[model samples]
Target: MSFLDATIVNVALRTLAADLRTSLDAIQWVVTAYLLAVAAVIPISGWAARRFGARRTFVAAVVLFTVASALCALAQSSGQLIAFRALQGIGGGLIMPVGQIILARAAGPARLPRVMAVVGVPVVLAPVFGPFAGGVLLDWAQWQWIFLINLPVGAAAALASLRLLSRDEPQASAPLDLPGLVSVCVSMVALTYGLGEMGRDPSATAVLALVAGVSLLGVFVAHSLRAAHPLFDIRLYRDQVFRAASLSSFLLSMGMYAGMVLMPLFFQSVHDTDDLTTAALLVPSSAGAAIATQLSGRATERFGGGRTVFYGALLGVAGGVPFVLIGANTPYPVIATAMLISGAGAGLSVMPAMTTAFRALSPDQIGHAAPQLNMVQRLGGSIATAVLVAVLQNGMDSHEPTQAGTMSAFTVTFGWVLGAAVLAAWTALVLARAQRREPPRVDAPAPAPQSRA
Candidate 1:
């Protein structure tokens, strides 16, 4: 339900604007507000979990999310819906990350890869199922049902969590790093909102917001350097593996989301498929990804990060070829095959990247790094979506009414996606070399607990 909510509203945005009697630009805030809230609050998840305990935090987040969903259903205006969505995001941001942290903590090093693979399946599937589900609900039921559906699932998850979750007492004397937290939150919120606004209108206000956001982020970097207990310790960047992993993650998401936003349009307009058919055709991508995740996780454990990433990137680029070459009459089987291959590549790449990032950090740092990586991935997705949409819109506007022109535009946009894939591949090569250079560590007892800073 949480994952579904992330992208489900996207396809419904136009309908929502008309129903709410709002302009397209104003209605965008509904999506932006939720994303901004999620990005802003994600940084504090580990701190909250450690301070209150994971089970307690998880349960509270579920309750909060459920309540927020109800509020969304009851919203009478765009502003109200946006506000409720933001409220929902606050809870939603914590759910997956906290669950990841718990799994990481419980699984230990030897079995961590397998656990991550299992967790990754739902993560990938969420976006795939979200749009399809939303389209179905919107076709048959009122738009409000989108939010209403979460109630039952959230309630069940909450109750299951109470039974399945282990209770741990809160940590003593953990520093909150309020200054660092405030600075980062301000920076992320400003940046996210500014970018979102720019997607609708690159006006003076939007430009100023973008500038302010960048400046705030600069301040955050400086604050982290000086603060005694920073929200995310800057020193972690010194780990070559972590740096490679995080950057690869950001770039991979950039490519993946850019393709996602573009492909649906291609399917609908170029192939003349209906919305449901387009959605259904895209399922192979997620299905392939889900299947490959487990295999990639195991491969990463045995073969190491470099080889896994290199092979995955190769597949990603190969998979992208069909989209680049797509014409007006491209076959559905070909499209589905390309999507599956792309998804397989994603599955192969992402788990290794995540595991590599987390493994490079200390257990205490895992909390911080997990959220930071999540933030980067979200930011990358947002930026990629905005840029690609702009390109597509421009292409559609300028091109003459011909099949060739339309295909040309798609080709040009996909060229950018291809560049992203190559970049990921190059980064994978660098990571491989770095991994080769690192000294091997003997399996040893786990380190003692360190308080959050």
Candidate 2:
């Protein structure tokens, strides 16, 4: 439901702007606010679970998310809606990570891949369905219905959580890293706000926000080094697999999102397709991705993360070629095939990378791992969008205002995406090498030696 909500409003952007009497730039905050809040709160999920118990926290988050949805539906102004969405984000951000933690804990290392495969179904489907559902709803109903739909689902999930969730006994609590938290929050907010404002005005406050965000992040790194128990233990980087996995995940998102942002434009501008047709054309990719996610998880378990990621990256690179070569006269079948392959590649890589990274950590380390991973992925997408947008705009400028020029721009931007895919593939290779070299640590004590003669 949360993931659905993330994209649901996208289709309703025009309606929202008209209703709120806001410009496109101002209205974008509706999405930006949610993303920023999600990024900010994810880092605290483990702490919240420890402080309030996972069951309690999970239920509370669901309820909060549901109520915030109601508030969003009722919002009369852009500001109110944005604020409500931010609240929704706070709850939504915690849901998946915490659920993954619980599942990981329950399934243990041996069963984790299976559990991840099961859990990944909705993660892939939600985004695919979100915009389509939102468009349908907007055409027939009001934008408020977009949020209202979550009520029943949230209620059911909350009830199920109460019954299904196992309580973790309270362990010794670490003091909250208040300074680190504040610094990181400032950094993320500034960075997101800045990037979101790109292509608008070079002299705008958004650029200043970006600068401030980077400065705050610098402060955060410095603070983390000194803190007794930082919000995120920087030491996790020392684990080569974890480092590689994290970097690969980020790069994967960058490439995936870059391609995603360009695809619709490719269809609309190059193929001269209408909105509905473009949407219809795009559906297969997401559907393929959702289906592949489960399969990929199983493959990861059987074949190992390295091989799964390597194959996925290879497919991703292969998929990019079609898009780069696609033209104004390209056939639907060709576009569909490209999208399906790319989506499947993303499915193959994402879950395995996430599961493998988390698997590297001890049970206790998950609190930190979940949020940090989420943060990296979000940041990667943000950066990718910024860079891709610039690339597209630059390409657009270099040609005449025609279908061919638009196609040219898209092709150029996709080239960058292909580069990112190659980088992701290389990162997977690095992980494979590192995994082969590192011996697994045995946490339990070795059996006591028999009494020696």
Candidate 3:
């Protein structure tokens, strides 16, 4: 639900603008605000889960998300919707990290690879379908259904969590680390918002925000190193395995999601497909990811994460090669094949890196670890998107505005995408080398426990 909502509303941006009688600029915030809110709250999610217990936190987040969705559906103006969306983002921010913590604890370190692979289905599926779903809904129903659709899903998840999720004995709750929390929030919000601004305008304020954010992040790291019970345990990064996993994860996201942004535009602009058709064409990528995900668990188990991801990353780059010289006249089958290969590589690489990272941490650190990786992933996507967009624009500027020019822009942009894949492969090699030094430890199977509440 969280992932779906994030991208679904994007297709509805124009519909939302028309229905709400707002400008495109104003309506864009509907997406940006939600992202900012999510980033802002993520650092604190670990503390919240530890303080309240993962199950309770999960339930509350679902309730908050459901209620916020309804509020967004009924919002009378753009302001109301943006405000509701921010609340919704907070709910989403909590859901992702807290839910990961619950799953991590339940699966334990040994089964984490298989479990994360299962958990990844929806994450990979949602964005693939989100725009398609929204486009379909707008074709048949009112614009508000976009938000309203979440109500039932959220309610169902909340009930299931209540019944199925295990209860953890609450740790001795400490007072909220005000300084650390504030610094992290400021750092994340500033950085995320600044990156968003860089995408749109690259204004002076955004530059200032970026500088402030980077400076604050340094302060937060220093403070976290010294503070007892820091919101995020910075010490986790000291471990070579965890650091490698995090680096690989960040680079993969940077490459994968930037390519995600570029592909839809390629279909719509170059192929001249409608939104629905564009979405349809992209299905092959998601399908490939899903199929690869099913195989990744056993593959990782047999081959180890580093080797698995390195091979996958290589395949991903091979898949992207078709696009570098691709033209408007390129056939759909060929493009789809490339996407399939890239998606398979993505599936092979991401989950194992994540699994490896989780195995390196204790259960108590899972909450922090999940959000930490999420933050990196989100920032990576943002940076990649910005950089690629600039590359496309620069390529276009140097040529006439013709079909050939569009191909030139994308072809050049794809080079950067290829570079990103190469970088991901290098990081995967790093992860693999680290694993060789200390192999991923798989635990003996343990008995499952029943829900406490």
List per-prediction Cα lDDT, in the order shown: 0.73, 0.73, 0.75
Q: Tell me each candidate's TM-score.
A: 0.88, 0.85, 0.85
Question: Model 3, 69-136: lDDT tens per residue?
Answer: 99999999999999999899989878877777666555655666687788777656565677778767
User: For model 2, what is the C-alpha lDDT against the true structure?
Assistant: 0.73
- Candidate RMSDs in order: 3.3, 5.9, 4.2
**Candidate 1 per-residue C-alpha lDDT over 1-453 given as tens digits, one digit per residue, 9 for 90 to 100:** 666787777556656877999854466566656766776667777788788887898899989999999999999999999999989988987887777656656666666667667776765666567767766777778889888989999999999999988888886546777877777777766665566556544678878878888887788889888877777776777888778877888888777666556665666556656556666766887787777876987897788866787788778888887778877777778878988888888888876776677766655566557777777776666666655655555565568857777777778778878888889988887777777786323231122122255
Best by lDDT: 3
The 10-residue segment of model 3 with minimum total lDDT is 444-453
Q: Per-residue CA lDDT of candidate 2, range 88-143, in tens?
A: 99998778666755665545456666676777666555545666676567656788
1 versus 3: better TM-score goes to: 1
Q: Stretches of candidate 2 above 4 Å error?
A: 14-28, 76-79, 163-172, 196-207, 259-278, 362-364, 385-409, 439-453
Each prediction's number of clashing residue pairs: 0, 0, 0
Return whichever of 1 and 2 wins on TM-score. 1
TM-score of 3: 0.85
